[model samples]
Target: MLGALAQAVERLPPARRWLVGLSGGLDSVVLLHGLAQLGGRVGSPGLRAVHVHHGLHARADAWAQHCQVLCDALEVPLDVVRVDARPHRGQSPEAAARHARYQALADQMAPGDALLTAHHRRDQAETLLLQLLRGAGPAGLSAMPRWQPHGSGWHGRPLLDMDRPMLEAHARENGLVWVEDDSNGDLGLDRNLLRHEVMPRLRQRWPSLDTTLARAAGLQAEAQELLAERAREDLQTLRGEAAGTLSIPAIRALRRPRQRNALREWWREKGLPAPNQNRLEALLQQIRDVGPDSGLLVTWPGAEVRGYRDSLHAMAPLPLLDPASVWSWDGIRDLALPELGITLSAQEMLRLHGLEPALLEPPLTVRLRRGGETCRLRGQTRILKKLFQEAGIPPWERDRIPLIHAGDRLAVVWGLWCCDLPAGAGRR
Candidate 1:
């Protein structure tokens, strides 16, 4: 096990820092000791131990102290962080605790640092079973990966191929003392239920249950990769103009199964959570049945999908705009619009002014117009709605399109028509 860990460390990009998560449990204690013993062989990445006190159990502080003592004996720097792990309504206490603990550890990581955890084959088998029972798709059934990016650093599960028994044996061989959580015996949590009830029975019949499940998870991961590749190819056909958005017409052209697969693939590509089957179905229905003029929006916790003309836009929730006010702009300098993540530079504004002299009036501002606003085109004033239709700018883009205004008078409709031109040039 230690040899495999040494090889894993050697394969990683050489770094001067490594943060090991020490839970003072048999698995983590063995991991810390193995790394300490293999220090010279692994090229010494300035190893340090981090213990997160979830504060859920009464013995949390003592467990943290034990980790600190072990780290001190191993001559590795130790840091202990306290995190609130109170469960929210409808959430499992174990899951909430783990989430809080990992979040706290992620906060401590720096760039190029690796967060090493002692997840083994047993844990992998349990995870796979839990996900399978939840009726998860390929991505979820793939279980935890060996390595993944987390914040500024990477998370490494070097002991993933090793079993719990191997880690316990190593700890016993080294005469290491570790605490066993009482909650591990509880069968209320899904993983615990699988471990205490289902797995024990399966292992009794097939002794290699853990090994088999781990292998199954690897196969699922490979299948997921193939599906993702196919999804990427399909996404090329559904590409839209804006980032993170998809073309509604193109999406509607796909069969229902392919559409759901494409949506799932898109979310996975963006590292966002996949919507439930019901939500995804509803989204597809809205795209197909909603009137072209009606605004359609479907939102989840971290993302949203909206239909705009022929495009289906998926993004973070639309920010609430202060529609009652307009930003003051001076012709002398560029205005930085942080809300839009865009800068209205002086050069662009000057270029606009040079194109249309009528746009130079005082109190000139940039703002979105309410529906039914009108502007004069050439010799006659026309409703902006008709002007957009004539210009061929789709109805959906009208709300997002920027209009240059001079106090109460509308100047030029950018990229469409100019109220006036430079001295000698005639309007088209």
Candidate 2:
């Protein structure tokens, strides 16, 4: 197992640090020990152990303490990140915990660190079956990846090829004690039910179920890679004038299957969820019904696809901020607009627009656009709409621009047009 893990680590991009996710379980304990032994002989990178405290179970603190003791014994640095893993409405507790665990792990890693987990072959098989039951496509059916970008670094499952019994034997032979979560005994959980009941029954008939299922998952991964490559080609052809927008007529030229594949690839590129078959059917109908220069919005949980003119844009759902909302700002620091997810800084006076530095005095109000407003850009009193149109700003982003005012005079606009130099302030 150590030799296999070493080969996997060597296959990853150059990393200066390694973070091991120590879960205080038999599998992770064995993994940590194997890595520690290798570090002593070969002078490995800065290796540290991290235990995520999901705060969902009654024994969560005890589990953290157990991981700390083991890391101390091995003389490895350890970090414990506590997180709220409460399930949202219509979400499973297991999914919430896994999401929170990965988020916390991503936060703890540095620029060139790799997060290593102890997911073995049996776990991979269980994941494949779970995704299959959920009607997932090739992307989900690919199961756990061996390595991928995590935060600013990388994450890998080094023990992915090892069987469950092999890790258990190593722990027992090396006198490594581990804490077991009582929640695993509850058959009410979906994964527990599969592990305790369904998998055992299947193992009785087919002895190499884990190995074969994981192999199937690998084949699905290969198929997904090919599909993604084809999608990339379609994207290059269908790309519109903007970064995210795609040409509607270009997409219409492809067959339905190719269209679906290309759209799914776009969602993946945007880090959004792929539309299911039923949603895709509705989306196709909507695309066909769209007219020139029309505004249409199609939304799912985390994504929204909007059409304007001859282009289609897919991104995170646009936020709505009041144009009448106003706040007082001090000129000493950058002002943050929470609703719009942007910040206003004084350093952009000359960089972004022709604004005066002295205009950002304290007690000045930060306002949002209320329409019918005009700005003097290049010595012309132009309507805000005209200025935005001339700059080629999209129609959707006009409302999100923040208006900076010093008393009654408009000083600067966020990422758009700016006013001329104020009376007392010098021009750049």
Candidate 3:
């Protein structure tokens, strides 16, 4: 296992840090130990262990403490993260918990860091069975990848080829004690039910059930990759506009399965959640019926699909806007809004002020337009609404455009106007 771990680390992109997800379970404990033992030979960049406390069960804190102690004994740095795993209405508790756990793990990883997990062959088999029960297609049945990008770094399941019994045996051989997660036995969870009930029965009939299922999962993964390649080609034909948005006309021309396939591929590329069968069908129906003037919005738990002017746009669910609330900005210096990654600076404004006949002669204030506004441009005073239309700006962008005002009067209409400047000024 240590030798395999070394090889996996070598295969990863050059990294200065490795974060081990230590759950204090047998699998994670063995994984952490194996990595620690391999460290001297493999020459790691750095090592740290992360333990997430979901706080769902009474033993959660104890598990985190155990992980911290184990990390200390292994001479590895440890971080304990507390996460809220409470499920929302109509959401599965297991899914919510997994989401919280992964999100917490992601938060701890920096760029160039690799996160290692202890998922193995048996776990993959269970995942495959669970996906099958849910009627998932090949992609879902493909189980977990050995390595993938997570947050600012990468996550890998190095022991994915090893079985759970092997990890347990390793822990026992090394005198490692681990916490037993009570939730693992809960029959309410689909994976738990499959593992505790269905898997045992299958193993009784065929002792190599885990191996057989893992092989099947590998085949499914290969098929999924081929399908994904085809979907990418379909996307190239159907996608339109600068936003990487999909064209409804082009998608509609494709067969229904191909349309859904292409859309799912697009969603995966955009990092948005893929829609289920019902949602995809509904989206197709809406796109077919709606005209250019009408907007179609379909929202799932974490993502949304919107249609505008024969184009389809998929995105993570955006916060609802409160029309009454407004953000204020001063025009004197560069300002970065951390929430939006938007920067507003006066470099251009100052350059304009330096020009002959001064393009922006200001005591300027930057703000969102609140309607009933007017501005003067090129020897004529016009309604702001009309100016936006003449400038070919979209309606959604009107409120977001930073309007530069001088005291009570609207001055320059950023990137669109140099009001009050002479006709021959040649603004910067």
TM-score, every prediction = 0.77, 0.90, 0.85
Q: Give the range where candidate 1 is weakest over 10 consecutive residues by summed lDDT.
A: 419-428
Better of 2 and 3 by lDDT: 2
lDDT (Cα atoms) of all candidates against the true structure:
0.78, 0.84, 0.79
Candidate 1 residue runs with Cα over 4 Å from true position = 10-16, 84-95, 319-428
TM-score rank, highest first? 2, 3, 1
Q: For residues 352-405, what per-residue lDDT tens digits would candidate 2 score against the true structure?
A: 865544544444778877888788867777788888877767677878888877
Against the hidden true structure, what lDDT does model 3 obtain?
A: 0.79
TM-score of 3: 0.85
lDDT (10s digit) by residue, model 3, range 139-210? 999988878889898898888888888877788789998889877888987788888898999999999989
lDDT of 1 by residue, 17-136 (tens): 888898999888888899999977857687889999888788988898899889889999999998889988866787788889889888988888888899999999999988888888
Regions more than 4 Å wrong, model 2: 1-14, 40-43, 330-333, 357-363, 376-381, 389-391, 406-411, 419-428
lDDT of 2: 0.84
Number of clashing residue pairs, candidate 3: 0
